[model samples]
Target: MKTKVNEISIKYQGNFKISQAPKISSSVNAAELLYNTWNKDQIGLQETFKVVLLNNANKVKGIFEVSTGGITGTLVDLRILFAVILKSLSCSVILAHYVK
Candidate 1:
């Protein structure tokens, strides 16, 4: 038998959370910050590309956006991908799986 479960796209209700992480145990390096954020924020096919920012102390400075399929073509600017990372004193980039 081939039964399938139906799915819906209703938005989930939740309040925004704000916290200060001016500095993490780890240095404010892009790679480190990126991995930490991913390990905490995402769930199930969240996105393919991820972006994160960090302060001089390597703490998450701001959000960029993480997704599974944000890329459109092979000619995309690699620099733009790292723009957030470059902008921050230290930042991180993480990759996630996409379910399309």
Candidate 2:
């Protein structure tokens, strides 16, 4: 006889309303939005790699920071980045690099 293995469970939790989704219409708008998000944390002293996940309609879904490194640069793991995007059900992404 063989024992059964437990299955993993996954869930996405958020209270965001679709009607309130913020849209990115221009590069300047994207940059400004990302700047505001990054500024909330102590991320200005180093280089950081972030992904702004978007929906099929190009509305904001979420922002995820992939990595942080020294003053000059940072590295990002594509696997982790894709995992987050997939988990969030995001249809698009904007790559942002921050340097201080």
Candidate 2 regions off by >4 Å? 1-14, 40-43
- Candidate lDDT values, in order: 0.46, 0.83
> C-alpha displacement of 56 in model 1, angstroms?
2.1
CA displacement after TM-score superposition, residue 16 of candidate 2 (Å):
2.9
Which clashing pairs does model 2 show? none
lDDT tens per residue, model 1, 1-100: 9999975332223344325554445334544655555634433334445544545544555655433443331222466655545554454433333333
Taking every candidate in turn, the Cα RMSD to the unseen true structure, in Å, is 13.3, 3.0
**Predicted model with the maximum TM-score:** 2
What is candidate 2's lDDT per residue for 1-100, written digit by digit as tens? 9999975433445788866878988999899899888855667678989998889988987788899898777889998888788778888899998786
lDDT for model 1 comes to: 0.46
TM-score for each candidate, following the candidate numbering? 0.37, 0.78
